[model samples]
Target: MTVKVFLATATVALGLMAVPAFAEEAPAPAVTPANAAAPPSAADLLFEQPQMRNAAPGSTITYDYLRRSGIAKGPFGAPLQDTVTLKVEKPTVAEKGGAGTPSADARDIAVTMFSGLNRVPAGPFEDMTGNPIVSLFFENHLRALAKVLEANPRYLKLAIRRGLRERAAVTPVKVKVGDREVDGWQVVTRPFAGDPMTERMRGLDDLTYTVVTSPAVPGEIVSMEAASRSKDGGELLQEKLNYDPKAG
Candidate 1:
């Protein structure tokens, strides 16, 4: 099945106004894979931010579910009409709590979604009330890549450094979405001599197939979509998050 991935934008609004920044105040910390640990689970990735917990009491958050149908080009890329539910809630402070702090409450506002491939009983298997679990596999792979890049800067051995140095330098790849380009790293495994040589015999490069994309930016995709000579089919999977200012 061949699945061509694309995104359409949607906006949801909460009544809260954006606060102006003060010049002297320190800048908001950069959210990088190195600083931010891999989310423990899919649920932890979605609504576990301080901002979500700090929404004013009584404010409601809205979600829009999208189901799209398109031609798939992969082993399992059958015509898929998938429905994804986005649950949005604005966290509010319960008045009964003795803490007088304005936003001390730690309630979570999240959007949970399940894919057609998911067969778990829905409760203890994976939390469906929190983050969308559809994208967990991609997140884990990207983080693993980042760890490799940071630890080993020289990824592939250049001809110049072959015998002179015993180390292989790892190169970092730039990840971009919209106008923001994330700079970090991941470790990809290269194939060794004992690996399958059929592709190599045909003059095709033989490389071990594992890549980690670190800092797992939202909207970044790690799927392959290309034309092949063989008629063999495959499965296609894609998920996207489109954000915009709340509708007027």
Candidate 2:
């Protein structure tokens, strides 16, 4: 089936967040896929950070989900709104006290979601609450992108991953947490800018994706967005997720 049709029928999960820690004091991890043994890259930090390490078992973090495409030649139809929650549970007895006991911060993480009419289940995302949900967010987006462009998902993922590791910008910013402001970092990346096949992407070659994270928040993610628009700004597709302060 075509990607559009598969998207309309198949159940896929997406997630994201934003916030930042001061870059001057501590930069995003520099480890990436190329060097699995090295420190994490910005991409690694964004998608693989130990976001829930500090949360006690039985705690939860929630996000507001949004997915929409413009009416003018947009790639998607209708808007999907939902609430996604990550629940942390205590590890089982064997995992807690035996020789195979996990690390001090180890905990069980699962997702509970309210997708309304969207009917998109958490799937792999269901068990991914330990790290930030942005991994699932971008994973689904990349899948959709590859399907829509009739490109290889593996290649597309690799390109984007490399772009995230090499071209992403990590900068300091401030975010509001309740009545106070906390330091955060805004990460931006344009993975397709250097793609040799840009012309075939139908204006998506310039798509921009951003992430914000902060150490002050319970979950480091503050917000995440992937968006693209036609040259004339008529057609567009935007997917984003933001931390809901009041709900958490």
Candidate 3:
């Protein structure tokens, strides 16, 4: 089965410099080097802190998603699961091009998908593969959290205007990961409203949903849930996170 994902990109205007207009004969005031403003710091420019500290290099995080369609129902529907391994490598120069100096917050993560315990490598996220879906979803969640942590008005505005579509608010929630319960925050996307979709699909309207992340670990997304309606309204996708110490 193939599923289509739509993402919206928004462009924001940072700030405009005021250019003084003077008479034709008049000369502008001299601008001294001392008057020039310094460049933004790394923390000011980019999110310098790790949102998912537990997902460090060489660490493994596994997630399982329950997908239900017309052919299947309940939790026993078509199996969708994946395990992501964080690569212990420095950020490539190419990735740092526009970002200028590199920061410790950059991450290189890879994911592999499984169907009922069988390995499957369909394609990348653009191909709408199961592996890509789980990986990209978490990636976006971290990016959104980073923006919120940075507290940069301009970037926050852009993030909201773009795909994230809403500022994350802290709502205390507890979830069962394995045997123990984990406390986290529930951040809902576009909480008040929903975005209109250009294309129609069964059991789906917009991509708006909610995600739970561990506050203790900052950026570790514990679970996600989104719903749509076909002939019947049900959960489109539900995912949970688990830490794998033995994964390599």
Best prediction by TM-score? 2
- The digit string of per-residue lDDT tens for model 2 on 106-188 reads 55667665555654465322223245366557776776677666776766776667667788877766776556677767778
Error of 2 at 198 (Å): 0.5
**Clashing pairs for predicted structure model 3, backbone only:** 51-219
TM values, all candidates: 0.26, 0.74, 0.45
- Candidate 3 worst ten-residue window by lDDT: 13-22
Assess each prediction's global lDDT (C-alpha) against the native.
0.25, 0.60, 0.36
lDDT of 1 by residue, 1-248 (tens): 00101101111000011112111211111223443333232112222323223233334322222211121222212222222223333223344363443344333334333355731222111111222322332332223222322212122122112211222222344544335656533333222223232222111112222222323432122111111111122111122222211311
RMSD values, in order shown: 18.3, 10.4, 20.0
Clashes of each: 28, 20, 1
Worst 10 residues of 2 by lDDT: 1-10
| Residue 167 error, candidate 2, Å | 0.6
Candidate 1 runs further than 4 Å off: 1-111, 114-171, 187-248
Q: Give the backbone clash total of model 1.
A: 28
Candidate 3 C-alpha lDDT tens digits along 1-248: 11112222222111111112211211111111222133222221112224433445455455544332222323223434445433333345445464454445543445555544545443332111111233354444334333323323333234433433334433555655454565554545542134232222122323355555553432355555443333343333333344332344
